[model samples]
Target: MSGSDDQSGLLVLGPLLRYVDETSASVWVETREPATVTVQRGTDSASARTFAVHGHHYALVELDGLQPGTTQAYTVAVDGATVWPEVASPFPAPVIATLERGRPLRLAFGSCRTSVSHDKRGNETHGVDAMRAWALEMAGQVQPADPDDPDLDPSRVPDLVLFLGDQVYADETTDAMRAFIESRRDIDQAPWTELKDYEEYAHLYALAWSDPANRWLLSTVPSAMIFDDHDIRDDWNTSQDWRRKMEATSWWHGRIVAGLASYWVYQHLGNMSPSQRAQDELYAQVLAHEGDDELDFGDLIDAFADRVDQQPQTYRWSYTRDFDTQARLVVVDSRAARQLDPDDRAMLDRDEAAWLDEQLRGDVDHLLVGTSLPFLLARGLHHLEAFSEALAQGAWGDRGARMGEKLRQTVDLEHWGAFQNSFQQLAHQTIDVAAGRRGRAPSTVTFLSGDVHHSYVSEAWPVEPGRHVESTILQAVCSPIRNPLSRNMRFATAVLSYGIAGPVGRLASRSTRVPDPPLDWHYAEGPWFDNNLACLQLDGPSLRMWWVTGEVHDGDHERPRLAKVASYALDADGNPPPREGTVSKLRRRLRPR
Candidate 1:
């Protein structure tokens, strides 16, 4: 069913490995023809059988009766053709990693990437695709053998990967994708021949995922993804004005529907737990069917996509995961579930707001919130938010909306701060968890994000005691695993955002004309400008957050090397006993199940 006849080898899809109590694990793959999928442990093999679903070729290998807390090396065989590690391939094959139960969890996250050819120039420069960097590391194709090795090895695989958004760019495509479109339709026309419907979207998904190196990494890594603006279009749902302008176009209608539908198939479907999958109405129907019934899923997916767009609050896009007592991760969907009224706009709607409120209830030792956009902006930008909010509410005399217009044209009017009311609510919820107002308090609440193109961390401390608002909330942000901002703009954003906004914002709050006083905010960590990959290490009660970038400093090695751009640890929560303090405390406390 592919548009092209590029007969590449079979691609194995995931939730590849499983955690404890995983009775069955399903693996998906695309093949030339219907094929038999088999799984084996040690010398024993499960019966190989052809998948009866469509010859479009997908399989769900229900691997049952496997021991937990033990690693099992496995391989995939399609139509009796082995695809991975290519045996004579006892080559220390990749294993199905069982849960360690209480071991410290490692999660690697970042966003905003483009799928380009990874030949010599591209590979050596941009550090091979960010996803490839991780995969090659995993396959032991790169250096420094152990897990502690500071290289971009997929071998440095984490317990899970939380992809914060922009997994695909429907707006910007590679030369190959553009060429493919040009062959079919006119790009200089009104609809512009860019991602118009399900047919085009399917091709786009293939183009995005076909990179062999990156695809291998995704096959083995358990990934969770959320979509941002680029997944559908630029500045998606920035405001009512922006939305209205885009909706009036002929292409945007089909683009939005196809984008959401493809996202459900390619990304979100694999993210859900089996229990969650069963509860999914669309997926349930897909599972209940037994043939190549085009009528089965095609219509259902279309309707669902339309519903999500028309009624943003009807379906929730936020999900939470608790990693024992060590941490709880909440991934929010800031685009689709937005409340975009011209007078009272917000990044999230009321249903989404309520969902986030419930998810943020702190009972874990550490809380992590993942938003594609940072909750806290740079100082200058923070002041800009304050200024715009004041002007929009007519606090700045009669020229309020005019002032807001000027600011909107220049500054990014698409972040959490653009919707001041929603931002305020989120800040209060975050602070509430941090201040211990909610039952069990986490030692720290970190918001992991990307999408401003530069990476940095900032902290917010309590200005007023017991107030779970910006009065005492802290922030840490990192961005653009591969996309870096221009040097000139970086300097401008830093100086203006920090130097001027710091004083002006604080002073404006004291003007008495404002109802809710502005927050006392400052730059605590970084506006560290670079295109880099960020990793967070949470070993026991001690947490260290840092960014790593590939620098080509006269190295004899052809591959890009990772250098520590910035590093900081959060170990101030009274852990004792010198160097072993944090670990010792963590070992003593039995985590709640």
Candidate 2:
């Protein structure tokens, strides 16, 4: 049966390529009914029956025994009937290209997309969707080249797309989401604009991924994802006070349960490798159920999600992948893994921090640390957050602490800088790796992050002069794949990130009891507020990074063209050399269209 056949009771969401290795691959899909899903690549195929969760049916089919480094076209079938590639798929057919030994990794990473129509209204209000524009460009549908711009080579397409966080914003509902929520419940009630249940979340994912261009891109590109605060709520688990406030709400239990549960099925499950999936107790149960009858895991999954919410120590959301000898991608769970105790605020709890420390060793050419919240914020913002944390912890006194706590939540000062203890621990660990005290120092220790709705590159240096660190430590941030901060907010961000705020912030922190920072850093590229996506290319000893945003040309808003915002390169030692020009000249060259 064809995928579009309403009577087929077959595929609904995807035949999305998930994790892939040299010998195995995993494809995820949702169905209208419980059925066996199969993935075939050449003569080899793998099948898995759908498991029901609250009446929603899904399966992750595994394809194994593929040749290393081989690229093979794949097909999806539901209940022994071919369904995908939909006969008229306009783009290239989906394929699985396993990671080859010694091949340099090229990755596209971005965060924070809002689901809306791709018409003029949506384009004007939300800016064009960067992922959709890139996908169109990649598919050879739209190509606008500039003489000064870097070449757009289809052959060098990224092997994977890392969705850093905010994959779906549960708190900041789009108009379509609000309409869906209102259809089911009273709009005037508590949590009026936020998602309420697994049903709502499923609909949100459908809206987020269902766009034709993006859907095609996701089908072909393997994806890895993690959640940020917006995936549950704005400032989710920000502090002990925030948690207490949320817990007091009438619908919080339901919201948290649904958020975590939906995240597991839609994003987290696909993030795991085959071996990791085998180790998961819940997935093991799915595998152990051998009967032809469909398996229902609704109640069990609900209970599991509740348990995880109540005791996050029971689960591990962070994952690591090593790309042969090229690089190691350590995608961290920063939001859910927080320890918000007033006495000991931490970005990651002890267990999670320990796991992260263990993963920070070096052996490859580069180490990429992916956290939704930028590890190194603008220097000024870093000091401000650190100062806020100290005041919130009663560093000055009880009254000051109360005022600080209020300001902290109000201003959303809860990144790594706010969690001083955890930040210090990670900083020390990263320093050790860079200093070659832990392992063979890579060319660079790069922190890949988003969540702040702007893009930038920053380089950090040791506090002591003449400190010999072999690895270049840098921070790369790309955000808001579709969402854009308001003009007023952008002005505020620019002032705080680039102007007098740095010295002022340091003074503010010194006025409080906040300790001195372990290191220092400055912006190397930008603090640009654009709805953009970033590409990171590791080619042998060189690394290139660039940001691209969709720009409307000649009033053609519906078909926005991709435009380069800024580009930077790191030499063999991962150092971005300063350009020999005036600041005005540099700005003129890098400014967005």
Q: Tell me, by lDDT, which candidate is best.
A: 2
Instruction: Score every model by TM-score.
Output: 0.84, 0.96
Model 2 Cα lDDT, one tens digit per residue, 288-404:
888888878878888998998889889999999889878999999998888888987799988998899999998888899999999999878998999999898998899989988
The 0-to-1 C-alpha lDDT of every candidate, in the order given, reads 0.62, 0.86
Lowest lDDT 10-mer window, candidate 2? Answer: 581-590
lDDT of 1 by residue, 145-237 (tens): 234645334445576767777777788776777887888888897556456777666667676666555565555555677888888987788
For model 2, name the residue pairs that clash: none
Q: Which stretches of candidate 2 lie over 4 Å from their true place?
A: 1-9, 147-151, 580-593
Looking at candidate 2, what is the lDDT of residue 545? 90
